[model samples]
Target: MASTDTNDIYWRAYFKAIKLQAGGGATEPGMGKEYFYIASNANRSIAASRFIPMATTNEYLYQEADNLMDPNAPLYVPGAGNTSYVQALYTYLRHVKRPRDTLTPEEEKAEKALTQKLKDAQATYRSERKSAMADWKEEKDFENLSFGAWAFKNARTFYAAWEALNTADGALQDFLASVYGADAQKYRSDMKKISGVANDILAPVPGLSMTCSNIPVLDVAEGIEKAKKGDRGPPVGEPVGYERPAYSLDPQYRDTMDRWAVEYDSTPSTGNAKVTWEQGSKTSWKEFGFENIEAGGGVTLFGFLRIGGHGGSHTEYENVKIDEKNSTVDIELKWKKLQFFNVYPGTWNIPQIRETYPEVVDLDEAQKLLIRPTQFLCASGLSITCKLGGQAKEEADRLYKKQVEAGGSAGVRWGLFGFDAGGGYKKEDGTQTSTSSYDTQKGELTISPTPTFGNCTLLGVRGQAVSI
Candidate 1:
């Protein structure tokens, strides 16, 4: 008859072989046993029944799908094929029960509309978050710079220049009123009308003409006209020529001031500085701080300093120098760390054994022989389970054909099965031998084996370490 008795025996054997390989009965080191079982179940279900309906197989596929979808899993693969197995199985089951090839027109339109709405919402959220973060960063940067000492000094200097200009202009107006009367008033009004343009022109002090000449304005204008006309003339001597006058401020003051301002502006406003020192039976860099050092005379030193806070915090050594010419402090710095953490990759391997019936005397002989040789078990348990599945299918097909010829209404169902009553083998001691019991109604397969240690070979392992 087309009974599942032989199928049950094969499944029992498959479970036993898997358990043995996975260190279930042997105290040998192995790959992760649970992971191996899961992988094996996935492989078996796909290979044997093409993921046919079985509570156990369904659960295994579901778990496998989740694992593949997880970003952290080593075996995870990106794409629908790897992550949609469970959903596809569910859809297949649904179709089998209520078969339909396509959705109705209304359903199709609704699905499209929902998909578009979801896409639009996601896009809007991303765009708004990006813009908000950019604005927050800009505001934070402005606030930090505004609170810095260098920024304060620059602002004070700028306002001082404005005040000086206003005072000078007021004095000039009084002098013009005394000398030119109504004409002076007209000049003042014209200046006021062009004040905005004057302000823009005066913003950058570096671009202003600082050189003073004793030559008359009319003579300088005549010289420029002659040069533009390509006239080859003898050099104008003494009073007729222009020459730079010595200023009260030092010659290098302008350059030094410019450098100081640029450096201070670039300095980040938070973090701690990492200092490295050399110790040779003497004091180190970390022990000394800049306290009694002189401010000028071209003295410069290199030392670590912190700048900014949180996202603003910058850590690095700065080239600090006091500019005597400009009576200002100058620094050059960059943000980042000089040291970092290291990382490493590693791997381990376990040896496995797969013996078929043709290569062994019998199941008992094979079990006894397998225990004598290996160390860590191959936790996957797939090698034997796959073979058993093929053998079981062949046996079931043969039996089904025979039953059909005998006019029986029986049919084969590829699912969980139990051994027939009184059909198990016997040990040399006359005791009944079975791996475990199976219940078809509950769709459960249980295997309980005695744990024992065995002799096995070791596998090679390797790893690498990297410094970052």
Candidate 2:
């Protein structure tokens, strides 16, 4: 029966906390604007004094407990008599025994006098609250930052009740303290228990990834985002978009390029003809077949048309399936023009071949062009076909998956894995290889690999690292 009653009190407190946290429901007016909507709000000052700090403390408790449990327990809410406890607490925090910047002589005297009375009442309340919670040592040990914060909040209400008593010219401070100060302690005690409950809920369970250490990394950003957007929603990375630049064609080059395209396309159908450049009536064309026009037989180009494959040109084409009807039967040919000037037999064919491969017009042989590391490696390793193997290969795949999952902008993971250490592989001999690793924090991996026999030594070293 007692447990049932405590559960009811807890749920009431939990609902109130939720309403305040979520900014919803019709609150009983007087607890700030949440309750301001209500007309007959009698306990306005008391409710505000009580619930405000309780709300804050409750939030901290929630954060503290969030990692421990899946379904966190509820806090305790003070009833009508306990509501007076609220006023008493506020009074103590806001008035008597409260911190003051500047106190007049009379005010200082009054404050001192009130402080004594407040302490006495607090002692009595603490005693009674311990009895109620059935846990004395634990509640008593809660001091300094945690206990001080609790006292400061409850004291706000205590001060209020203290003021109301004195103003009404009742044995007000003393009488009010005597009446509800114990309840104030009970409220404090209950709050402490609720905080403990939250802590317990958030405490890490055996073998579970849910720990105080890891949860913040996973949930803090999401929680804050939800709070900001007015919903407990997950976080999405930075919103991104691309604006297409306006496209405009140069009207001047249109005529010459088109006439050249038609003339080149009509002539003897070279090796292969493509309208390489198309703009209005103007177009650019390319045909590959013979080498030299004047000498004949060798591939030569006149206004984008080439004839012959002998001299410096080589024929390479892939027959790609054009459509379903002709699948393997009829294939469209796709090929690239290859001009190796270094292998050409004579210098007389060089000038015409240079025109065919215009890249021969480099003024500075010493100029180093900036190339992507991946592209450079791929090009340099033409024999081995050194393609980007792991993360780089997955970049486009990961991006497409994220786009499809998020559909708009919600599904992106924009950071690297925490455990990634940079890696490199080196092979001095054709059959022997070694590997190196690096860490961001520790700085470097001191890995020295020695060959057991130096022949056919294949080593695969793998380990996981964590980052803070």
Candidate 3:
């Protein structure tokens, strides 16, 4: 009994020592070290004792404790003292007094490595974040820029030049080049070259010149059509019509006229011709350019200038006063109309808006509105439409039932409270807002507004839940 008691006491002490150092446990400072004895033959003795009858439980416990104290002990701590842990420890140590309690060489090296790694990570994260933010801001700014009237006007001029000449050299191109630099210059030059205006492409404007020489045969045909129809000729008092042929012309006179016709029959070619304006007129739809106005080749001919206007009104006019007899047919050219759009405070359903104005509901807005959640608040002018289907329907039904119960509070004799999803106290807006209600059992505490013009107002009560 004495041996057993002594062995038990030693075993307890040995286990306690191991727990204090290896595991977290209570141990007095300075006193705990006295219990352990360093022995050179401790391992051999422990092995021999294990095989002998003297291998008591206390000895086993002591051996186990020694093994645990060894640095090679087989124990695991998850991600023990990694970079993050080291960094945290470093931060703590920064404020700690360290004259006599400074870190060892290994710890100091680990601290330096961890600090550098963290700095590198932070720098990389900041760089990436800044770049991403800059790119997003630029894209957003570009979109907003496109919304301006000046931007639209410039875009129209640029596109018109490209469309007419198959190149981009109009006011928009010049402005873009000045602002955006040489990269835009190539774009303008490329577009103009594509439009068959390789040299001196005329920018689309009132007085811009187009050498009519190599002009497409189609343009000549158009001119002949205009002449035959006498479209937009001078006033009736002004003499302008197809010349009358004299039936009794002598052979010599006819021969001379034939020579003159032959000389003028060929199409004029404008290669390096320096076309300059001779005269300008807005009302007459005629402008003269080139060297000589009286003789044809020296004059630049520009006809029918058109300008644009705005507002809810649009105008379409035709010049029917062709020559003296034949009237010209009216043609539709420039038209303008004022388009008004409503700005919804929320992402209004596109389909709903389309129900009101189908023309404005495009595919882009339709998809955005349909997918966005109702909880999100949006700016004015933003419209959204949720796709019609199961999830929305279920949510709508749930909300309607909740609102109905809420409004029924004043009317109910027992002052019954209601629960949503599970039935309990709730707010009206909690169930739903800015949405429509549908299919419900009639006369079952249905809450709806008194007046109707695609709108309604209803009052309801809230309830609390009690667990029994």
Candidate 4:
């Protein structure tokens, strides 16, 4: 990470450069973007805030187990931009000349065929990647059991199998970095720390790892209705979730545990009994950006307005539960709340702020407004469940529609989480800070707090299994 001042300068230049350009591709090559990108990929921004275009590659298709297991040579290393990254960029740049280069008829025809092959390759690669990943996860853990003693014990076996798939062909590692996005390296670090490098004799044993609620739309909707009438569970599956077993298996209760370490009617639960956030959690204002705010346009007033705040945010969790039958943990979180006041747009100038908030007489008031909060409880829960698009989401939509009549989601826009699947907006004041983002397509939920939100506490409930 760059020093604070450097980071600020870096971000300023990066944002300014993007604004100067029309986006999708850079136009202002002199704006230091090239310098920032070349400083090493580690310094690059994330997809949500990234001004630099990332290279796409097919190298993951040919990676070896050594590279797959080695943190230094993994298929995707955002920080390093690794080897595959360079290959992808070079491929694009090399092929880019095809458009401008004059060619004979035979060469043009050959080029067309090659272009078609690459296009077909893209589709084939994507399809193959999706199927392979799905099969791998299923084979590895059909149940998707939460990490605990089972994971701790089998951690090495899991890694061994995964790495083994990376053979001379390297198809197993294809787009592996895409799986965790920016967290690829962080995950690699943790896994290496956990079980050591897969095949390394020096690798140490992993010690071991969500109790979050994920409801299928129909089940959750039915549950809600049943709750209203007292006819819950069954016919519509009980709301099942795993939690830290009510009573952790203590050494004193060693005899109670099954010697086989298998789940049964009386499987001894180990570790903590509950998960909590005793005091409410809050986050300071982290800013956001707009999507090509001007799309294909450039250097407008919106360009000057880069960093925007979504105000501050806070969350309170009222309950956490688990169900043995379902083999799942259910975390019922109260809606997260947003807090802020002088939350005027971050890039807004004096005239803009004065016009927006007439009470502000001068720069001091405007500055004060940025830090202070006149309203503690602002917009309701930040739509944790609804935005993920499931039973919870459908239920929310129906609820929202009941408020606006029966036309359906038509003319209805989803203004929750990061707009348009993770972010297309800028970090200006007045925008809501991105709290919980769910990738419905990937069935992944990522909880990230803003850098500025110091009091922000993350919400989660989990347990570990230890030798009783």
TM-score for all models, in order of appearance: 0.14, 0.16, 0.12, 0.21
List ranges where model 4 is wrong by over 4 Å: 1-95, 98-101, 140-468
Q: How close to the true structure is residue 131 of candidate 4, measured as C-alpha lDDT?
A: 55
Stretches > 4 Å off in candidate 1: 1-3, 20-115, 119-468
Decide which is better by lDDT, 1 or 2: 1
For candidate 3, give the lDDT of residue 377: 8
lDDT of 3 by residue, 92-193 (tens): 222222223345687557556654544554455445434543443345343232212222343454333334332222432333233333344543443233
TM-score of 3: 0.12
**Predictions in order: lDDT:** 0.23, 0.22, 0.22, 0.23
Q: Model 1, range 143-164, lDDT digits (tens) per residue?
A: 2322122223444544344444
Report clashes for each candidate as comma-separated counts.
Answer: 8, 50, 20, 27
Which of the predicted structures, 3 or 4, would earn the higher TM-score when compared with the native? 4
- Residue lDDT tens for model 2, 1-468: 111222122222222322222232322211211110100000101100110122222232222211111001111111211111112223222322212234567755764666566556555544543443233124543322232233335444433433433333222233323333334453333333222221122121232111111101122223333343445343223111111111111222222222222232233312221111111012111110001211331211111110111112332211111122222111011111101100001111111211222232213322111100000000000000111223332332344344435433222111110001112333232112222222223322222221211111111001111000
- Residue 190's lDDT within candidate 3 is 33
Report the poorest 10 consecutive residues by lDDT, candidate 1.
459-468
Clash count (model 4, backbone only): 27
